[model samples]
Target: MAQRILVIGRSPGVILDAAERLRGKGFRADATNQFDDVLTDYDTATVDVVVFGGMVPPDSKRQLRDEISKVNGHVTFVQGLAGIAGLIVAQVESVTSAAGDDTGVEYDAAERTVRLTLRQPAQVVVEAWWATSFTPPEPASTSTRVVDSRFDPGEHVVPLPAEVPAVASFVTVSVGPAVHTFTVGAMPDAVRRMASTSALPPVRAVATHTYG
Candidate 1:
């Protein structure tokens, strides 16, 4: 059977647009503006993924999430925010607002494309950002150098003193039921390394449901 997807939100245009995008990618996409009605439908349908169009109201968002969890154990949720400030707080399962100061980065391993969102009201050189992969060479040194002809000509090596020391640029943010966090440091290099090493799989489709 085709993968089933539920899109929940008040905006039909955004919800339908997302549903179309999912359909193009070979998913069985369906959408509903009535949040309450969608939840009832999901109880009977086998939904594989869920995508919320915008920020869900706090009460409704929480209630729907609780209901869905009782039925679907591992339903992946994607909250689409509008701006940077909105994105920052949107790590919660149901909040979707605007993508503000912080840039939103999405990596599609299957498509091999990394999508980035730079919010307005801030001026920063996004092109200056870099990402790379790192692995311990023989006789692991306390420091490693990262070279990128595009950004820095001289080898730009940083110290990796610990066995998996967290990079300063990366910060933890909680999303969903788990305390999920994502890093923003050196994404380009990390993507390349992950692609080459087969460490991460292509991002799977997100699932959503509506409740009355």
Candidate 2:
């Protein structure tokens, strides 16, 4: 069966455009301009994913999310869309394929590298920022790095700044449109012990969140 996708937008024309584009890409697609109608249709239709168009208000999207969660938790939610048709299709594909895999930052205490793993191939980019405060101090130094090349499905580790203070408290990993955060706590010491080991450190499972 074709994947069922629901697109909600403020403009009826734009919603219809995206729905048609998705349908051309082989998805069973539908579009709507009203949030209330979406909830009404949910009971009558089986949806695999719901994407909020760029014009949809953030608050309305949140409301739709809450209401949808009550109806079906397995359905994936995506947003932060661009008007470009190809990019929108790619975004949907990436999010849908990323299910059931690790998609976050893992610290390698010994090598001082942050390993990011994704379930599918993508041009992955990551940002590792650190500071003494759990909230991270203002003007905290943030280092952004991109993988030297597109990563195939699996793990890729990028080295962090050697100057990173032991007091570093947080790290955020971004893979395509998905982002995941981790609290530092005792990661520094853990990395040190890992560095001393002759065996490779086991890949740690990390949870990821999507933002629009």
Model 2 per-residue lDDT tens digits across residues 1-212? 77877776544444565677778867777776665566765552357888875545556777888888876767888772333333345556656554444565577766667787667786665444443321111112233343436778887778766555555334445565554544443334533343234453232221111110
Best by the lDDT measure = 2
Instruction: Report how far off residue 64 is in candidate 2 (Å).
Output: 0.9
Scored against the true structure, residue 27 in model 2 reaches a CA lDDT of: 79
Clashing pairs in 2: 109-191, 110-191, 110-195
Best by TM-score: 2
In order of appearance, the predictions have TM-scores of 0.40, 0.45
Show model 2 residue runs off by greater than 4 Å: 98-212
Q: Work out how many backbone clashes candidate 2 has.
A: 3
For candidate 1, which ten residues in a row score worst on lDDT? 122-131
lDDT of 1 by residue, 122-209 (tens): 2211111111222311101122222212222222222222332333122222211222223333223432333234333332233334
CA deviation > 4 Å runs, candidate 1: 83-212
Clashes of each: 30, 3
**Whole-model Cα lDDT per candidate?**
0.40, 0.55
lDDT at 70, model 1: 77
